[model samples]
Target: MSRSRKVTLRAHPHGPTPGWAEVDTPPPAPDSTAAAFFDVDNTMMQGASIYWFARGLAARNYFTTGDLIRFAWQQLRFRVLATERSGDMSQAREVALAFIEGWRVEDVQRLAEEIFDELMAPRIWAGTRRIAQRHLDAGERVWLVSAAPVEIGRVIAARLGLTGAMGTVAEVVDGSYTGRLVGDLMHGPAKAEAIIQLAAVEGLDLSRCTAYSDSANDLPMLSTVGRGVAINPDAVLLREARQRGWEVRDFRSGRRAVKIAVPSTAAAGLVAGAVTAGLALHRRRQRVS
Candidate 1:
């Protein structure tokens, strides 16, 4: 089983507003056997949630501008290029874990709550939020499945009035972050494994469930469910969705919906390389000091 943690839904202290408004349409009868799983980045939201969180922390002076730039570049690559290689995933995990090492879990959760409202809330896709709300209206459980830290995922899920969330587990010891993951990242094939275990525990029928995502990296997860939706999918996922007859939703405008051309991608790659070198130099200077 993947080391994804399942968080139970709870009311937020600030009483978060739902992304979608209340509809006059009557809700359907409860469907206890079915559920909907949604991916976070580029699916339910406009960009990477973690990148926003990192930006928020940067605003609070938690890290240097160089660190935030590195994060931003990584998110850009992930969002536009759909780069999800094993090495990239490993590097992201290490950077995130190291940054939070020795921090209190509760403190991180509190900051995540604030950051979600300030940064994440505005970025949520209205169309995707409506789809999730539709599942809720039908009395089916809705869960955000993400590779983000479980605490961050839970905040998003709770704020959106979803059932809960399944996300990557970061180990904690004595109420503080250990800077180590409990298992692997809750991504790619691991996401499929996590939900399979969750279904067994929650009595959900796999065939009755639906999964939504924006990346081809989630092929395992999208394939596991009965219905697969591609929301603002990358070129690879878009092609696969067309070939597989999966439902596709594009909230972006015609100009924005076009795939990033090779020139833009190559330029972004060059910028990322520069930012990465700067971040490395910054880290080296800190160590030297």
Candidate 2:
């Protein structure tokens, strides 16, 4: 039987009003197959998921406006330089984790699903979603691979009717976060590594699998698969795409595609906020916890 479409909105035990739904997806297991993997932020959607989550947290009084600004700056730095250049991504990741030090894991998951369905869902590129659907129609498992927390990734997959997702793992103690990561944030090389592991576990044929992303930060992920498609590529990535002769689809090619990213800046503006928030968090970490 398919997953139930009915969503039950209720107050979470963690003291938040979030809509929860029964999840029917099984974790990855040994299975021979071909799959399509898509990056979530700036690839399938117009902006970063973490950015919006942070905004949600801000609205909930988790942090201040200055915190969000500092966060955005760091995220922008990590996104712009991590793939093409050597720079520590942990600087951005640590603060993002610390931003929700005492948050309950279940609460974040519920909130992410609700926020995505209400705010970020329409922000997802129709063209990108259509591409994923085509893969699903072809009987391929579609997974959303992203640096965002695995919870957010799964929410995106479930909402989009995809198979599964792979994302950065955050550490939790009991039901609350420990403000730490279990491993490297799923960025740059980490994304490739995660896919490799997933492929092995699922017995997937990498030679027949396809991967898609929009940033050079995802170069490793885009290159690891047999087929790589660049969607809404920036100038740098577009240049690389041309050099590699990889297929590319510019969702920003016209005003029509711009609707998915209304004001187009909504996603970008939030992403830029990650950097500012990260910086602020870093400074705070220096003086306090």
Please provide, for model 1 over 1-289, each residue's C-alpha lDDT reduced to its tens digit, 9 standing for 90 to 100. Answer: 3343444455555768434333344335698999999999888887777667755665665556555455656546654444645545666565445555666898989999999999889988899999999999888999999987899899999999999998988889999988788887888998999999999999999999999999888999999999999998889999999999999998877655443222123433433333344435545676799
lDDT agreement of model 2 with the native:
0.75
Show where candidate 1 strays beyond 4 Å.
1-28, 67-93, 254-289
The lDDT per prediction is 0.78, 0.75
Per-residue lDDT of candidate 2, residues 1-289 (tens digit): 5533444556567756575655455534433478899988778987677666655555655556666555555555654665445576656576546644666888878888878877788778889999999888777899999877788899989988999999878889999887788888887889999999999998898888999988887899888999889998767788999999999997765765555443223455454454345434554765696
Clashes of each: 0, 22
Question: What would the TM-scores of all predictions be?
Answer: 0.75, 0.74
Listing every candidate in turn, what is its Cα RMSD in Å to the true structure after a full C-alpha superposition?
Answer: 12.0, 13.8
